[model samples]
Target: MIEILNPTSLPQARETGALVADILQTMRSRSAVGTNLLDIDRWAKAMIAEAGAQSCYVDYAPSFGRGPFGHYICTAVNDAVLHGRPHDYALGDGDLLTLDLAVSKGGVAADAAISFIVGDFTPPESVALISATERALSAGIAAAGPGARIGDISHAIGTVLSEAGYRINTEFGGHGIGSTMHQDPHVSNTGRPGRGYKLRPGLLLALEPWVMADTDELVTDADGWTLRSATGCRTAHSEHTIAITEDGAEILTVAGRAQP
Candidate 1:
């Protein structure tokens, strides 16, 4: 379902977005070599509870995933890209980790994701992959505004990824997000411009641009949740939730570090 927040609820949306961004940033700081993925999940759980917020992931039973995600955050490592279920594994040096989080506070929800390298080892390829996704995400956000079409955002994102020589996957991309986590008006990573739903004020969208280094194919891990590259190539994903406004687009899920 597509949901547009009322002006009054927009404040709550900003609050929830800040909370989500802060939590993800804290988790990223705590993540390092030898840090267990389960520990990260536990940290997220504690933080969500402390903030009186609800996790949009844990207990989530979507058709694409096994029932009840049972994790506070998604810990996608190196080859893994989306829906990565937290496990007993510990992060290794130079491991590319993607943390995707969504939470509801004051009846409004925001979703965001970040990809970064763990420890002191940053491979050139990994750095490039992460940069490409971030650039694509920025492009998508720049293309979003009141009266703009969804395809315009998708096309901008696709242009960035394609130019960076990464393959785009449309099976799982960004979407409308509001009171609930995932909503309608599916936003693919790549699409033709001047097509699809026109943007309007109060509409919230989570624009994510993710890509695999080599192929567009994906293979699910044994856990039935984690989606990895079919060729086991490294992947990167970047996302943020934004609210369309009269002036343009207001980014709700800006990273805490980037905020004043």
Candidate 2:
């Protein structure tokens, strides 16, 4: 279902977006070597509860995943890319970690993700992967605005990843988000321009650009949720929720940036 927020609800959407961004930033700061993935989930749960917000993930039962995610946040490590279920594994030095989070507050929801190194050992390859995803995400956001098509955003994102020598995966990508975490108008990481749904004011979209270092194929882990690179190569993901407006796309989930 695609949802467009009313002007009155836009404030609530901004609040929800800020909450999600703040929580993700806090989690990233707390994450380090020896920090268990489960601990990160616990921190997210506590923060969400304290904010009087609802987790979009914990009880999520989507057809693509096992029923009831049962985790507050997704912790994708190293080769893991999407739907990363929190586990007992502790982060090691230089581990590339991705945290994806979504929450609802005041009847509005926003989703975002960030990828960063766990400790002081930042491998050059991991740094490059993370930078590529971030750049792709920026490109996608730049392509979004009223009258723009979803494919334009996807093409901009794909261009960055492809130029950076990373393989793109379309199985899971961005989507319209509002009262719910996932909605219609699926936004692939790569697509032809001038196609797909046209952007409109009051519409919220979660634009995520993720890539694997070597291959586009994915393999699910034994947990039945975590999606890893088929070749076990490292991966990175970057995302943000933005609201389309008359002027342009206003990114809602920004860590230290001003909200439009």
Candidate 3:
């Protein structure tokens, strides 16, 4: 469902966004070589509980994924890109990890994701992948605002990835997110501007730009949740939740902000 949050509800959205951001930042700070993915999941669980917020993923049972995500956060590593279910594996040096998180608090929701290299071994390819996604995310955000169409955002994101020589996957992209985690008005990583849904005030959108180093194909992991690159090439994803306003778009999920 598409949800246009009211002005009063904006505070709750911001609060939820801040909480998600803090949890992600805390997790990122704590994650390192030898850190277990399951441990990260446990940390997410504890933080969410402490904040008195609900996890949007734990009970997520969608047609595409295995019923009930059964985890606190998504932990994608190296070749993995999306819906990465936390496992028992420990992180290694030079591992590219993507952490995607969403939470609900005060009856509102916000979602965001970040990709970074673990440990001191940062491969040039991995760094490039992460940088491309981040730049595309910024472009997407810059294209967003009241009166802007969803396609405009998509085009902006696509230009960056394509110019970076990465292949774009349209299957899973950004979407409208509010009281619920995923909603209508699917936003693709690449598209034609001046098409698709028009932006309006009070609308919340989670624009994510993800790409694979080589091929655009994806292969599902045995776990039934993690999505990986078909060629086993490294992948990266970056996301942010923004609220459309009269002046422009207000980013809701930037990390390192003082909690409200």
Question: Best TM-score goes to which candidate?
Answer: 3
After superposition, which runs of candidate 3 have C-alpha atoms over 4 Å from their true positions? Answer: 256-260
Q: What is the lDDT of residue 155 in candidate 3?
A: 98
User: Which portions of model 1 show Cα errors greater than 4 Å?
Assistant: 255-260
Candidate 1, residues 11-69: lDDT per residue as tens digits? 78888888889999999999989999999999999999998999999889989887799
Show how many residue pairs clash in every candidate, following the order shown: 0, 0, 0
TM-score of candidate 1 to 2 decimals: 0.97
Residues 65-96, model 2: lDDT tens digits: 87899999999999999989999999999999
TM-score of 3: 0.98
* Colliding residue pairs in candidate 3: none
Cand. 2 TM to true fold? 0.97
Model 1 backbone overlap count:
0
lDDT, candidates in the order shown: 0.92, 0.93, 0.93
lDDT of 3 by residue, 91-134 (tens): 99999999999999888889999999999998999999999999
